[model samples]
Structures are given as structure tokens and as C-alpha cells.
Target: MRVCLIASGSKGNAVYLQSGESRILVDAGFAARELSRRLELIGVEAQSLDAVFVSHEHGDHCRGLGPLARRYQLPVYMNPETFQALPSLGRVADLHHFDTGSAFTCRDLHVETIPLTHDAARPVAYVVETREGRIGIATDLGIATRLVRERLKGCRVLILEANHDETMLRDGPYPWPLKHRIRGNHGHLSNGDCADLLGDLLWDGLETVFLAHMSETNNRAELALECVQRVLEKQNLCRPQIVVGRQSESSICVSL
Candidate 1:
């Protein structure tokens, strides 16, 4: 399996995943042209994508879904609620609606979907099971539930949300209500939240961790990495290669 984060931040979010003969995008946040450029940066053509899996209807997660899926004639997979929420997506040639907790196959990959704790109409996360191993993608989630931990267990690669630092969020320039919303159970995860959750999920087979969905105004990459590392060090566990996903550029392609 191969994975790359095309973009990760408040501005937009997209992830590229390829396994066997399957190539798919988890989200298409940027415009079609911008998504194409980013894919080109990683030597992946947008037209080569076979399918798209949407997490929710948030603009930052699905803004480019309509244009990209239409232009590429890609099959889109999402829960029925999320599809209904995307009336703005206009007409898509192919659509597949999978139940939130069901597992489905996309060509050579087996994808398991789990509902996420977010304010969207119906948000979800994905665990892609490849021949090599499983790759878990869970972002825009407010908290990691038992079901999430269960679904994500045994994954070789994890893309988890590290949305903000609690102190930074409290002291940052954003107003109180917005801050409260972000700190809410249906909002986003803090750095501390991410670290604690990761500590519970750490294991020997975990090869790489991508700290994703960071807040530009309230969190730093160094802080997110340090927090997770500290938690692992205290437990004397072997640390995985942790990479911070950047908002402006594609991540180094990871293969397993």
C-alpha cells in the first residue's frame, strides 16, 4: 500500500491511497485543477483515481468532490446522509452508498468504515485493508471512541487528527465561542487528546503515524510531535516514524 497526504489543515484536506490495482482519494477538498496539480507533484494523475470516499459534507473536505469526480468519472463512496448533504455536488456519474459501519471492497482493497464524532451530517473514517496491511485514516473527529480504537487497531499506518493545542487554543486570537466549539466533543481533537489516544493504540507493528488536521492559528507541528513522542517515551515503547502533515504541500509518499 502507498499513501500520501495531498493537503491537511483547516484550509482543505485530501489523502491519496493506492493498493494493488486500486487508487483512490479519501477527500477532494481543493478545486479540481488544484487537486490535479497536487497529484502531479506526487506523480499521480487525478484521472488515474478510480474512486473517492467522502468523510462528510464540510466544505474543507468535499469542495472539489463534484468537479473532480465528474471530470474523472470516478465512483464516489459515502454514506447516504453525506451524499444527501452534498446537494451542491450536482451530478456525479457513479455513486456508491455504504453504511457507516459496513465493510466494502474497492477493487483490490477492503475498506471498513466507522462513524466519526463530528458536527457534520454524517462523518466517517476509513480503514483500508491492503495485502501488505491496513492503513487507517481518521480526521476531523472530535474524540476517539472505543469503536474507533477497535477499528483502527492493528493498522500499520495511521493518519490521526491533532487539531489543536489546548493552551494555544485558549490563548489564541480566536473568539471564545469558536474556541469552545473547537474544544467541544463534536469539534476537534487537541494535541493532548491526540497523544492520549495514540498511547492507547501504540504497538510494535505500527510503522508510521501522520499527525494531521492541525490548526494554523492554535498549534505547531513541533508541539504535536513532541506531545505524542513524550507519551510514547514515558511508556518506554518503540516510537514509530511520526510525520507532521503540512497544509501547503504533499507529504512524502509512504509505501508498505
Candidate 2:
């Protein structure tokens, strides 16, 4: 299985996962044209995508669904709430309504959607298992739940969010109310929040970890890494190969 970061952040969120003859996308946040170009760089064509699994109605996660799926004739799956929020497309439908809880099979790939905490109607984090191993992709969430920690347990690869630096967000230019929303339990995960969550995770099989969905004004890769690195060091866990996902571009495919 090959996992590619198409994009990640408050700006946009997308991931391309391929295993054998199957290829699926976790989100379609980028513009249709830009998404096609990014996929091509990773040796995939828009028409080759098997399906799209949406997490919610938030534009950062679903903005391009209508345009991209329609243009390429791809199937889309999501929860009923998320489905209702999108523009109707011939092949798009709700995953929960389909009776495929957080877990479903799309071709040879097995995907599990872990429920998420956010302001959206219904949101989720995704864990994809393939012939290669298990990989979890989670972001745009605030505090980690017991379910999330369990679902992501032992993932060979992890794409988790380290969305902000609390201090930077508080003292930086954004207003207090906006800052409260971000720091709220229902909002994004801060660097410290991310570190604390990873500390409690069982990391035996974990190989790689990428800090995704960071705020441009409030975070730097170095800070995100420092937080995780400190926690990993204290726990005596395997120093998982770590990378930071950028908002403007996709990250290189890391071994999962």
C-alpha cells in the first residue's frame, strides 16, 4: 500500500491511498484542477481513483467533491449528514447509511472511519488497512477520544494533527473569541494535545508519524516536531520516522 498526502491543514485536507489495483481518496478539499495535478505527480490520474470517502461537510474536507467526482466519474462515500451537505453527484452516497460503520471495504482496501470531535454535523478520522499494513489518517480534531486512540493503535503509519501552538494562538494576532474556538475542546488539536495523545498510544507496530493540519500563523514544523520528539523520548518508544505535512503542498510518500 502507498499513502500520499495530497494536502493537510485548515486550508485544505486530502489523502490518496493506493493498494494493488485499488486507489481511494480520503477527502477532496483541493480545487479539481489542482487535485488532478497533484495526483499525477504521484503517478495516479483522476480517472483512476476508485472512490472518495468524506469525513464531513466542512469545505476544507469536502469542497472539491462535487467538481472532482463529477468530472472524473468517481463514486463518493460519507455519512448521511455529510452526504446531505454535499451537492448531489451520480455516484456519491453515505457510508453510514450503507451499513458500513467506520469499517468498509473498497476494492482490496479496508477503511475504518473513527468518529471525530469537531463543530461539523458528523466527522470522522480514517484508518486504512491494506496488504502492506495498517495506516491511520486523523486530523481536524480537538481532543483524542478513547475510540480514536484504540482505532489508531499499532498502526504501521500514522498521519495525526498537531494543528496549533497554544501560546502562539493566544498571544498572536487572532482575536480572543476566535482563539477560544480554536482552543476549545471541539476545535483543532494543539501541539501539546497531540503530544499527550501520542504518549498514551501503544506504538509497538507504529513506524511513521506525520504531524498534519498545522496553523500557518500559529505553528512551525520545528515546534510540532519538538513536542512529539519530547514525548517519544520520555516513553522510550520506537523513534517512529516522523515528517511534517505542509499546507501548500503534498508530502512525499513515507514507508507505512
Candidate 3:
């Protein structure tokens, strides 16, 4: 299994996953042209993707979905509510709708969709089963629910959210309502929240961790990494390589 975070952060978010003979994308946030360029940076071609799985209807997660699918004629999988929320995505040639919490196969990969607490109509997170093990792609979630913890257990690679720093968010330049929403139960996770959740999901086989979906305004990549590193240092059980996902470029590809 190989995973590359093509782009991450509030500006746009996309992930590339390849397992066996299957090459899939978790989201298509950037415009088709920019997305293509980022894929090329990671040595992946937009035309080579087998399918795209959407986690929600947020622009940073699905802005390029319409053009990408239309141009490439790719299969798009999302829950019915999310499909409905994306009315602007007119006539994607192939559409596969699955209920949240359902499991589906995309060629060589088996994907288990888990419901997420977010502002979108129907957000979801994916756990893809590969020959090497499982790769969990979960971000944009506010609270790490019990179901998320259970489903993400034993994953070899985890792309988790560490969106912001609590103090920075409280004192940031954003308005009150926006700040409150971001700190709410259905908003993005803070660095402290991410570390707490990571402590719960640690295991002997957890080889890699990607701290994704960071806030460019309220949080720095170094702060996010240090927060998680502190948690890892407290315990000697799990010591996975941590990679911070960036909005401007692709992360180092993790092949397991």
C-alpha cells in the first residue's frame, strides 16, 4: 500500500492511495489543472486514477470533483446526501452512492466508510484495506467519536486531522462565530484533541502518521508535530514516523 498526501490544509485537500492494481483518490479539492500538476509531482497521472471517494461537500474537499470526473470519466462514490448537496456537480458520467458506515470494494481495495461529525450534509471517513494492512484517511472531523476510534484501530497508516492550536484559535483574528464553530463539536479538531486521539489509536503495528488538514492561520506545522511527538514520547509502545501534510505541496509518499 502506498499513500501520498497530494495537498492538505484549508486551501485544498487531496490524497492519493495505491494498493495492488488499484489507484484511488480520496478527494479532489483543487481545480483540475492544479490537481494534475500535484499528481505529476508525486509521479501519478490524473488519467490513471480508478476512482474518487468524497468525504463531504466542502469546497476544499470537492471543488474539483465535477471537472475531474467529467474529464476523466471516473467513478465517484459518496453517500446520497453528499451527492445531493453537490448539485453543481452536474452529470458525472459514473456515480456510486453508498450509505455511510457501509463497505464497498473499488477494484483491489476494500473500503469501509465511517460517519463523521462535521458541518457537511453527510461527512464520512474511509478505512481502506490493503494487502499490507489498513490505511485510515480521516480528517475534517470535530470530535474523535467512539466509532472512529474503533474503526481506526490497527491501521498501519493513519491520515488524521490536527487542524489548529486551541490558544491560537481563541486569540486568532477570525470573528467570534467562526471561531466558536471551529471549536464546536462539529468543527475541526485542535492539536490537543488530535494528540489525545492519537494516544488512543497507537499500537505496535502503527507505522506511519500523517497530521493532516492543518490551519494555516491558527496553527504551524511544527506545533502540530511537536504536540503529537510529546504524546508519543510519553509512551514507548508506538513510535511511528510522523509526516505533516502541507497545503502547498505533496507529502513524502509512505509505501508499506
lDDT of 3 by residue, 140-164 (tens): 9978999999999989999999999
Q: After superposition, how far is residue 171 of candidate 2 from its true place, in Å?
A: 0.7
Put down candidate 1 lDDT per residue, 142-213, tens digits, no spaces: 778999988898989999999999999999999999999999989999999899889888888998999999
Candidate 1 has an lDDT of 0.93
Which model scores highest in lDDT?
A: 3
Scored by lDDT, model 2 comes in at 0.81
Indicate the worst ten consecutive residues by lDDT in candidate 3: 229-238
- lDDT against the true structure, per candidate, is 0.93, 0.81, 0.94
TM-scores, all candidates, are 0.98, 0.93, 0.99
- Tell me the lDDT of model 2 at 28: 89
RMSD of each: 0.8, 2.1, 0.7
Residue 157 lDDT (model 1): 95
